[model samples]
Target: MQDRPTPGQHWPITTWQGWQHFATTPPPTAPQPGEPPRSTEERLAYHSAFVTVRTPAINTLATQVRTLMLLGRHQQTTARPSLIVTGPAAAGKTTALLEVGRTCHLAHTRKHPAPPGLAHQQVPVAYLLVPPGATAKTLATQFARYLGIPTTTRMTQTQITQAVCHTYTTAGVRLVLIDEIHRLNPRTTTGAEAAGLLKDLTERIKATFVYTGIDVAATPLFTGAAPNSPAAPASSPAAPSPPATARPDPSPTSSPTWRTPSTSPTTHPTHSPATPPTSTNAPPAASEASPASSAKQPSPPSATAPNASPRKHSKPSSSTTSPKKQAAPAPANRPKRHDADVKKSADTPNDEDFAALYDRAWDILIFARAGYLDDVSAHYDEVLHEIAQRTEHTGSLGKTDIAALVVWKRLTAQTRWATDLMSLPDTHVRAVTEQAVTAVRDTTLPRSEAARTGRGIIAELPGLRTGDALASAVLTAAAPQRMAVYDRRVQHALDTLGLTLTPAPGRYGRYLQLLDDLLSHGAARADGWSARDIDTALYQMGANPHPAGT
Candidate 1:
């Protein structure tokens, strides 16, 4: 059997829970309805003014990287429609397009790490987010927050759109990166509320758009019936019709058939046996007819001979020759990576796959949580077994360290797995794992202490309970774990870098939680900082950046 990558083995960056949080966050409010829309003339005036001012650098390469920014500016200059980008988180999609803003004369900003060199640019660009829990009205309200437009200004969706369109056109705002795009998938009000609001905003805005979010939610946007597919536009001209005779007729009677006439062959009036009819019709007959034949015989009077019959007309039958080879049809949609893909990747080890193992392990962790374990002892034992297995792998990075981190990351969005990890009946194992997790969380202490603490905690908790049962409780509580998980590879990185932190108290979960909090706090306050900012910063701090930036 092929080796399927365990989801527990590879956890993707964002979790199911993360997506929910994004959708539930409320959007800012908007102005009243029925307000008049800004006039076309007004919008044009703004575009004209900005166009006159001239923008900055144009990325020489200009690949698909800048689709959103180019689109925004195109709309501003040509008065064309706007667009929305939708995709998984940490795809580096936004950064690619944001480069457009970097080069252009117009100013724009990212949510975090701030837009580079904001000091320059003819027109000032500002960044705004589509806050959590936003509806159509609220989304409009948030855009107003940064555009210097007021939510209470009492504008209808259409009117608000016009004013905003006008502002971008006039102000030369070429692009807007709507980070945390998954938030648009709200559970409240049948979900269409958020979808409708986004559709409305795209229609109303003159600026180009860049949407960033989790891969699953973005799947529908890019793959569903939406126009964002990789397919060609529907409006293109179709292949020309073949010749009329080349087509097949539905009616049998209309089908072409070859026919022959019943007329008998004609005989020469007199075959002299010495000569043929050529003699009579030949040049000698020209002696009888042609000194005047130079007169062209009056062009044969433009008429056929009276005795002449219609000649047979036949079309060659359709040939059955083998068909010509054609190029394979291109897929109309983007390719998606699934579990099978992971296995396929593992079989063929490359730098990319090697780097992605940690994430792959995380996925395994999620899949493991489909059931709950009640016996605390069994749970801890299973957890230990898992850790031990991870430690067996050989690579530059220690398998144990990576496994620890993977477990911690997975448990964040799926805690039940850890609490009910295994079916063993040993209470001591649970204690050790818990101790390991706790030790990691208490950043100031050594990991050895945390391991001991976990053991102590388990010792104090009574009973040789199965870890599975506790896992169920953990899942039921929906409590996020506090520890940041670290693996030996991670430890090696820290050690090599000469950092003093020790993994004595907790496992990877402790470290992950701590880092998660710090980054989350940073992102929340930064307003325009994209999820990428947090990821890049953390990876740097760890001194172990994912090859592709994950």
Candidate 2:
């Protein structure tokens, strides 16, 4: 009898009941790849019609809000900075807001877990669309609706506000999502009263307020703030969305990705020399150049993988090469399926300035990803992030734990692999995923070998056999600091930058290797950068190959 949330309800979140349903009901059995057509017509129709496309903007927005949640959790006072999401209708403003709310929902559940038997009717997130002809009392009633608090026609706005605020506080609501904000005209007496009520609720309930409306920045929403209140950040940039997209604000520190930096050819695969050699004088940093089996070479070590060789090798043959540059040599021990990865590292720039070859394309990516570098990079760094730190990755693993990780991977990648994920029995899936994640979490394993060990195990699942994209995301979610994400876009960006990443079987490990080389050049956390940040940068570069800046 329980209802599940549709993808529509939460491109931006879930209803309280929707969230409860997921908490209570176990997932249904997913069909195997080779299984015959035993599912009903309704199921087939549902599968075909329910499509979930990944949206980078939503990921960015979700990451931003999650970061904000971390900020609020540590605060000593109740007042938190409110966010306003305004853009043209159909631009996914509501979707972004809801997604953030859902993120908070999951994060809260993860933090405070309770089984169905012990679970209470606690509300951590509330989503409300500004009602048509909204007024102070009407808006207050909307708040009451979510909590199922009865409001009679005789109830005064003050009484409603007191009841709503007290209930939300008791329910432990942390996120208050308000959409269709443009419908409220602050200039009107009623609109002003509604606005005041909103301010009062935000102050009294101890929750972060997020407002979404159409073209609200230029509307009265911006100017209507009481002179004494902290006005919504003058221009709270709208998060990105695929449909009716909203533009993200530009990053101030974002510079030309095309600026070619010099790198040493002979440095270790794990890291390049602080000041790279002018040329490839020494042997190409034995990046997959010398297969571990092909020669008596010791496995190289990266910061993350102290015992294993880095997987990716970027030997710039020519910084002058126009669009579409070469990738670094592949690891020597890669599967025999491909040979390009094993090629010797070229005697060229270890580092090619992003601008030198793909300035325009990379510049555009920088414009997008750079704006959220701090938030997105820190996406997994705290309470709201994806991966737990090395210390907290302990305890027994279960199907739900694995399912949670799979969900995290889907959210971060924004892909619709739910069907693929459902292929294996939940228990079997958990067993395989646990092994893979455990490999990466091993503090003693060389970072490179840990990645290889982990990637190998996860690849056993149905959808992961062919590509490293999803597998890499899973691994990164396992150890956010030690691993970077890889996908076609990251690959394309690398190749376009003239960096190398062959399509060989061991590409996942090599990709991390490449990231280490890049990170090494900048020095370990010198600029507070990590494998994830570099991965995001490269993803940006590959995502938009032909940017306007070019």
Candidate 3:
């Protein structure tokens, strides 16, 4: 345990020693007014590390984590309450989480000095990222990796989990910090199980957990509330950045490195997205951010130092990199599923709604067909099954197949969509739909990301450009088992059931996650269920929701 990484070697932050270094190491010093980096390497190094901005939001988070840690320490049998920090991407959620971890690590070391030779062995904190398409096994392995536990390919998930819990406990880890919590889509089977695993760990380990992500409150991720263990968790919003302000600099700018700290705040405190009563499932829109560092470069360079002496040409050398960096920040938006907090909160669902539905998820699956428009709806499974076969064999759908789904989806939709898709030339529709189909079925991407990519590509087709109903249908048709259909009806049912599935972009992906969650809760009752099955149930729930007989 006393062993440390070789100097300058890439230390995995997931490991205990790596985290120990991060928690103890200080951020690089910013260039002073008179001291700018002289070379390209210096500029990159300066831009690489995120600036630590101590705003009111991060300070509050620190205090909350500390309080919860102390409270969890005394709890011998109960699951401790945890904290969730949600905000926009690039809005400092990651930065704040790290700062809080650093504070916790140093504070613990000062308060609980190891006695004699046991100094380095008393690990106090652990950190991990919720991976893209995180599974229970992957998550458990991450924990093992953080603690340097040896895991073989032969190890079962249960065995790995048992080892991790035992090791973390033995290490005296009191605080567990997980970043990118938004990646865990509780609606997906794997996401739901991963979420369940986390909840289980909270109960089993005597540690306080702090989760940070983009707008986690607004998505089904908030449905993280479980009855067996812990108290309810609390959330803190990220620091509000002021409007973007810029300063004039005569010096040549670095494409990637920092400019003077822009006086104007580029970001504001992102308010939690509120679900309107009418459209509870309108998920938040989001995009990925560049590196977390805040280095703002100066303006682009002038041509040949523009009418100046030849020697002055070198003065503005930093200008060349400016355009690339400036253009790079162009659209670092948030994800459609990067919602704010727990399912029970926000405008999506109420506790009563969940109590009524989550427990009887099986009833929804088995009985939804009876009340549903069976005459029309039954054709969906048959037709989709055939279409799915085609997609499986060909890797993309043809124009006729695409058109059939558009017609069927619109026909079943409560709100009939009028579109000119039928009139479009087969070649045009075929090209766009195929591109979308391929992106959605991409094996490499997380299903959520794949849905987003596919949606953007498919929206070029008629009718799909405006609403997701047709696009979702096509994507689901592309991979029936892997994807799910979404429309206002499904949204209505989810809202009624106290679940959140917004119509924000990339919603098709989120819809699958929502279905996965039901299947997860359904357990054995939902055996052999597909995301498509959940959509049918949602249709029924939205059509008529209430007590069984009444």
Candidate 4:
């Protein structure tokens, strides 16, 4: 057995090539007697850390999305078609969009000359998350918020919409990415309303829409059908037929049977003794008689002569062998001829059915298909393993400390809160850290009591607001098993499971209850994993559920 790494000790960075290698390298087996087993809290803490890996699917999808944005920028009269990029939780849909956002930002900054009369640089891409159970007004406000435009509760829906359009137009936004689109429950009236709002936005604004969510293909917004309509079929078209000339004839023997060409001595008249055989050692023979005399002389029995004495002459004449020799080469050359014919037939384009077979167009790019999860899960598991390895030497850190770090990382990973948290004063950080510890401790209380306590603690965080992502992150970190972060990714995961979190009165409470029920009654709890593990798993499932055999 090898010596195990000490907990909380920082490993030399030069020893590892990449996070992927660090994650996949197996750790030492269980320690000997007197040594302690790894704690569950440490495992949970490592699993909850934020990491980003760009898989092949993410890169291909990002390239396609960038191409669409470029096309939208060039279009003058045409209404650019909306793009839908959806997958299971943790599929990295948001990460891909963020990459696109970075590209657009870089392009904007690199422009040599500012557009005439523009006070600020034009933003080519506007990326925003769709609020949970978002209404038109809520969505408009979110857009405005992304644009850095002041939004207030006092503003009417129409005013917010107008402001959003005006700001995006002025910024020269060519593309808008609306993430967590699965939250728009098509089963309710709000779903249709949200779809209508998006359609209106595209018609009025110059930007093309890129919507990302979980199993978005199942939703009416992408399927282009009513919620109640028959489900759209899912399949790729059949393989195309070979061209007419390439098609085999109906006759059984149209294609010749494969066989080795004959190399027998009897087939060569000159080589056979009975068929006027020529000797290899002898000099060439010259005809001595004139052509007239040769023709008049009785031609020695032709090799094809049927009545020739079989006892004396056993082999056939050149006349009988010539035709077979010519036919032998035909079979050898047949395939090449057939292929050329097929090519010619394909180029002719005489068949209407063949043209029609390829006329279909694709509007939705469904990322959440079978086998997607396997790729994403392997990538995520590798990341978690790497974190566990790094933190192995830090065993002295208490569960609360690990949990607080997890909360901090997750909260700050959000685009809106990242900068604010980084610039926050030390006193505010300490308060937030204390609140996280308390929140985790309070999970032992009953549901109602815990909710009340959790809400109070969340309200105390310096920069956090009630029902926002930061507050939810703190609460989720404290009691991960019982509470879940109600962010877009979580919502999309729930939607993929055919579940909905209604944003009615007491929406946060209802959301918590829904997650609790899911853990208790849904497949999520079957593995006996902790709430935090389940949350992470579901987020991955929503982001990019691995398909079969991935």
Candidate 5:
């Protein structure tokens, strides 16, 4: 018999069985001559593959949503309180909701065998997306379908609502998540009716409502502004009242140098030039001639005296100028004026308002490639470096270059289409590239015309559809500085910043303009970051389901 081949030997296989055995067996462990065990790149690539970067913003928001869900489950109330998760498009609102739903579902299933005598299984959470332009009837039907209730074409809205309530109560559902609520048009009559139906359900059902949407705060539903109901109070707390004695004198200018006596226990007698002392032996009343003469003698200059004081008070003015000169030198002796100005500006009411909004409304988590490298898995740094090295060979990215990136990234929702696009012939790929270049260069064309050109290119590609993500990706790549990617994530981010884009097919240009405005704003532009970088940050923040610092 032939001697068996050693583990590291590369002996020729003579039979099919030998070939199969060779294929199935693990690779030899022997190291090659002068070869190190594992390179830094290899190790980094390995770590980066498994690392999921989470931000503090995402964690806090998720925790808040989860806590609210749990509270709703155990609370005893006729009208269950609801939560609104509003943020920019693509900022992980749906992801966070789904995560909470999954946790609730798992907890429900773990108690698989209900306590003895409990006839039905409990569904701790129920989730559904609101269809675009959904009406009262459509919403009711959708809710019914989620509850596994059969619906007939003739079923009335009232009937469907009742069925949904009955099913939810029977299933013991404590939380209901409604996503894509931005699709619900409150301007329409049907939309108003649908909102009312949802409100009524909250009162009728024991389940708490958790809504996720892009700029949901702008909607009447979350704004706490029902038709005939009072508007919700502002999120800011009321400013505290000043101490009564510390309040400014009502007529500071009328009484020049009158000193107000302190009411404190440690009070001391005080005097001012404007007020004359009264003694026990002095006359109770002054003669009219004496008052006229006193009035003519110029009273002490008040603190509120005009910048150009009367010539008669020149003596006191000279004394005040000396103090002013002293303060000027003191300012010079102290820190830089600009630094003090910055501090004062930072503490302004406008800054405080922004801070409050950032704390409350801007709760969405943001992720960036650079951020991922900061104390993240050591492998990610190398991975990012590799990506940078590979892309460096490509000339400065233009429309076509960005198109290639989008294609490689597979920005489309349809996996199969992305795969087909990736595997397209070199000629077809070149054709798409040229089309992108032309679209970018044709600035004179109207937005609709440019969009038509983009759509035509998408149509040429097999299995591709003309949607916002695909179209916007092309334009954004073509002009990264002038344009932004218009998808759910971008929309959601804009919404979080208090800018709501109308969801219309013809509003693509408007969306682009709004994104440009945001990037151009003084505060946003102060960091000197590029539009593409900002877009990436927005995408990461919007897409992170699990925030790090919860």
Candidate 6:
């Protein structure tokens, strides 16, 4: 055999077996260099990310998303934590929420984007926006979908709650987001009542919820908790023992503020034979008993208490029970006039009452945009002038007549005025009507409807689209003429600011979707953003009609 090679040397093969080994043996290889780890963007690209927003906030929102994703990982075996991004109009709450859904690896998220701009996230990390003209059922349908609950054609609140709990529990969701909460209130009683039902469903569900609204007051049900509160300190300082005094008088404004008694205290009889000696002393005048006392009166032992010991209490019999038991206390009556309701009612619009106001303002915007504020007939200007004077004196279009007058003046003005009136409270709408007419004395009229509609197009603005009913009134007043509704100003503002490149639309739904997508894109770039930022930016975009330097 050939001399054997050394231990460290390559072996010499001469035999058939050695040749076989040599033929099959692997080569001595050089070390391979390691490739760099993939980044979030790379991984996301591999997954085919397609968000389209380009705002700077997106990067921040992306960071939040990573944190949330990490948090979600820990939550995979438990309830997921809820994330709510609330802010005023145009704040990117909805968009940021969508970014979470798009970038996060949570099971899946239900996205419900609403019209006229309201976006929210809900249980199981589902994102939803309360419909523009939301009613209780409209909201319920969305809730049911997010929770994975089913509802019948005519499901009741009880049914909705059961479905919500069952679905949320089954889906392993821990959070729910409600957006554009302020639009919940409606002009009609039916609308208001429906809103109340939605409010109740939210309270009943156990999922952690985040709600977005224009103002803090608009969402009293949610953020009502003390800021940075702990878990109720194990137990709240025992609800202070109510002091003895007359029952609190019913409040006149307690229409929708009914406090449902989840577990009513057992009602005591008017008087008790087994009454403790402590309470048996001369009955204090009803006026003297604190309101708490009246609400908690014990029944006479002989009539209502079957558990009373025979020695200490007389037995109650069927005969002792009156044909009609005294009426149980009605639940705390609903708040007749919560500030929201008061504001809504006071702001409600009516027909011809505000007709003239609309007419005059319409005329003004038309004239101003068309560059013809000096050719209108003197009488037309005078009518607007008079209506403006009346609105200023009244301070608000609370009455139908006043709204009609305002509408009339608005329609006849030389420049477009509808967009300006949208954000103002009724009081401001009235005052502004006064100022607009005073500002333009001899505005020219558009020669024809076609010319007028084409000459002045108001950019869609947030908070401007009244419901179908209100829109109908204004559109009708302008007559067979088609004027683009000022319903998506925020979107237009974003586009104008170069924050977004998407073209704004006249319809409310389109604009809402666009904004949601943009915000989501922005949010995906980083941590979540404050609603104030979104709102402030949009407001600033619109505050200057000429786009801030034009």
| Winning candidate number (lDDT) | 3
Which tens-of-lDDT digit does each residue in 1-550 have in candidate 3?
7446678776778888788778777767656888754688877776666556555434555765776676557766434546655555655556666778888888989988767766466688899998886766688889889988998755666788789889888888888888887777544334544665675576567787777777665554554221101111211111111111122233455222111111112232333122101000101112221222221211111231111111111111111000011110111222223233322122444455443455554554455532232212111243454566567666676667865664454343222333366667777776776787788778798666687788888777656776666677788877665677776666655665556565565566666555655655666656545676567556655543221110
| Alpha carbon lDDT of each predicted model | 0.30, 0.49, 0.55, 0.41, 0.42, 0.32
Candidate 5, which ten residues in sequence have the lowest lDDT sum?
Answer: 320-329
Candidate 5 wrong stretches, greater than 4 Å: 1-59, 73-77, 111-120, 224-550
Candidate 1 vs candidate 6, lDDT winner: 6
lDDT of 3 at 442: 82
Model 1 lDDT tens row, 402-457 = 23433422323143433443333344444344443444346465333342344344
The parts of candidate 4 lying over 4 Å away from their true place are 1-59, 74-78, 112-120, 227-550
Give per-model TM-scores.
Answer: 0.26, 0.39, 0.46, 0.33, 0.32, 0.26
Best by TM-score: 3
Q: Stretches of candidate 2 above 4 Å error? A: 1-15, 18-32, 38-44, 47-49, 74-78, 224-550
Candidate 3 — what's its lDDT? 0.55
| lDDT digits (tens) for residues 1-550 of candidate 6 | 2222345655322221232233233333322479567778766554452233423333444444344334444432222222223344444444444443434323332233323444223223444566775544556666675433656654554566567666665655444545665454322222333444443433344444444445423232222221101101111101101112222235655321111111111222222222111110011122344422222222222221111111111221111101111111121222222222222322443433233332332232222211111111112222222332333454322224334533432322232444454434755544433332232221253112222232122112211232221232222223211122221333334334333323223232232233333233342221222221232223223322221111
Better of 5 and 6 by TM-score: 5
How much does each candidate deviate from the true structure in C-alpha RMSD? 32.0, 28.1, 22.9, 34.0, 30.3, 29.1
What is the C-alpha lDDT profile of model 5 across 310-422, one tens digit per residue? 12211111110000011100011112222222223334536644344333322222223222111122211122222222323331233334344444333433557656665
- 2 or 3, greater by lDDT: 3
Rank candidates by TM-score, best first: 3, 2, 4, 5, 6, 1
lDDT of 4: 0.41
Which of the predicted structures, 1 or 2, would earn the higher lDDT when compared with the native? Answer: 2
Per-residue lDDT of candidate 2, residues 55-145 (tens digit) = 4334545555555555556543334445556555554455456556766777788878767666555677888878885756778888887
